[model samples]
Target chain A: MEPIIIEGTPKTPTIKFDSSKGEFEIKGRSIPENSVEFYKPLVDWLDLYKESPLNKTVVNIRLEYFNTSSSKCILDVFKKLEAIHKAKNDVEVNWYYEEDDEDMLEAGEDYESIIRVPFKMIEIVE
Target chain B: MSFNVESYFSDISSGNPIHFYKGNIDSDLINKVLDTVEGKLIKGNEHSKLRKKVYNVLVESLQNLYHHVDKVPDDFEDQTSDKFGILEVIKEENGYRIITGNFVQADNVEKLEEKIKRINRSSHEEITELYKFILNHQRISSKGGGGLGLVDIARKTGNRLEYQFKKYNEESSFFYLNIFVSENY
Candidate 1:
């Protein structure tokens, strides 16, 4: 599968998924006009990647902020990864939050508590 | 019997007093407002994290207006048409004040009131725990059109939610919410 790269904006995040290296990254803001439209392709890519089953899949999320719709899409992404992890694939999610952003750190914890996949919360110093 | 167009234009355009866009609020307009606010913040050399918080709150508030407000006209093309919401960022002595106002139906006021009260009553740590608890146990309820959005706003602001409601009619209310993130604070 070809890699997907999206530009980031004040209201949208950049999505870079490398199918070969199994490194998926979503960064910046995420308040897209239509969350479903912005995330559909990325979700589809994840679905396709699940079939090939990379030795290790690392999903990195460094979102400064996102809207409620984006939150739902993030949950969907995690649920998809959890499914892949359950199938005995190497899947891991590294959720990075700013050192002082306790809110984002808690959000990571929220996702961790719900999903069955391995989620590591890392604090990035700015 | 003549209209004073020049005077009206002069009064509206003078000094850039944080103009309010009142008619239909759409994604394009919202993006414009977000850009304006962000530009001002960056020009002022404000903290990057606080700017992010303000931007997030702006989007969530506008989305609430777009999806839930009932005053929107049927033919309004913009996502936030007739939504009757305001997003204003005023330069204060310290930093800036971000304000958003919209309308809420009467039936949904009680739930909103309860949620805000609960959030305002809790400490930051408690609110964090509550956010996780809700995320885990409570399925996103489609009631009021913005289930977790409000919670996310409260969480981002890091302060007790401040709100006021004015009786618009027998069945609806005007909701006003204000959040302040001081550059020094």
Candidate 2:
């Protein structure tokens, strides 16, 4: 599958999904006016990747902030990864947060508690 | 009390007022506003993390107005502008405060009051629990929000939400929501 590289906008995030390398990452703000519309392609891309996912899939989520709608869409993204992880594939989600951003840290924890995939939290220093 | 436009603006713009818009709002206009606010924050040299919180709160607050804005009662002059709302983002000495006001049916106020009051009454730990519970078992509304915006705002700022309402007529009222985020938090 061809890689998906979407540059970040002020209201959206940057999604760099390299299916060949089984590397997926999302960064920056994600508060799109219509999150479902913005996230549809990525969701479909993950659905395609399930058939021939790389030996180990690593997802790096380094978002500064996302609104309520984006939060649900993000959880949907995780569910996709979980589907692959359940099929005996090696999957790891690297959740990064700023050192002082307790909210981001806890947001990661919330997702961790809900999703079954292994989450590696990385704290970025101020 | 009659709704005085000047007093409403003055009350919400207590701090160093940065931007205020009052009129019909939609997704297109909201994206434009978000862009302008992001530029202002970036130019102000706010720390990256702090900037994110302010921007996030602004997104939720403004979007709330966009999705659920009700007619300001047909009797209030022109009907075209009845779908209007007010937004004021001010920079405080310590951080920033976001104030948004929009008209809604008088009947909805009761449910909103109960919801916000419940949120305001919780401690940090309790809020965390409620946030998780809601997020995990989310029944997303038509607005695409799972009712997590208010909880997220409280969690991010560690501050209670301040709000008030003024009746516009027999059918509608203006709802004002105040949220402040401290840099320390």
Candidate 3:
């Protein structure tokens, strides 16, 4: 599969999904007014990735701030990963937050509770 | 008391006003407002956590206005505008206050009020649970969010969502939302 790489913007996150390395990462702010439009391609790409199995997939999410709309889209992305996880593939999610950002930490926890994939909460020091 | 847009905007725009906008709201304006506010937050040397919190809530608040703001009343001064609204960012001693105002059809007032009241009544943990539940169950509408913007704002600020509905006319009313983000929080 051709890797999907989208550069970050002031309002959107950087997306890097390389199937060759089984590596996926989303970093930066995601406060787009139309989050569905911004995230639709990623969700589509994930659906395609699910077809060709990667033995192990590691996903990292490091968002500074995402609006509520983006939050829902993020969940959609995770739900797709959850499908792959349940299909007997190894999937791990690394959720990163700033040390003082308790809201972000709790956000990660919220996702951890909802999704079936294992999540590791990593704190970045200010 | 009846709500008057002119008085409300004048009252809130005073007292160390940072940014105040009264006009139509669209995607492009949202991006500009966020960029302008982010620049001011950085220039002020606000703490990272506080800055992020304020920015986050502002994003939700503005987007809420974008998604939900009603058309200006036909007789209203800004009749030419669509999705007309007012936004003010003020500098307070302990924190920043973000105030947004927009007209809503009188018919929709009760529903919107009940939603905010329900959110205000929820404890932090309960709100978190509610957010997760909605995230999982609710489908995203064409308007974009799954009714999660206000809930997310309350969850982030840990404060009651202050709001008022002023009677604009028999057909519609103006809604004002005040959100405060404290430096110490």
Task: Report the lDDT tens digits of candidate 3 across residue range B79-142.
Answer: 7778898999988888899999999999999999999999999999899889989888898887
Q: Return the number of clashes found in candidate 2.
A: 0
**Clash count, one per candidate:** 0, 0, 0
Give the winner by TM-score: 3
Pairs with steric clashes in candidate 1: none
- Score chain B of each candidate by TM-score: 0.75, 0.92, 0.94
**Candidate whose DockQ is highest:** 3
TM-score of 3: 0.96
Ranking of models by lDDT: 3, 2, 1
User: What order do candidates take by TM-score, descending?
Assistant: 3, 2, 1
Candidate 3: pairs in clash:
none
Which consecutive 10 residues in model 3 chain B have the weakest lDDT in total? B1-10
Docking quality category of candidate 3 according to DockQ thresholds: high
Candidate 1, A18: how far from true, in Å? 3.1
lDDT of each: 0.72, 0.86, 0.89
For model 1, what is the alpha-carbon lDDT of residue B150? 70
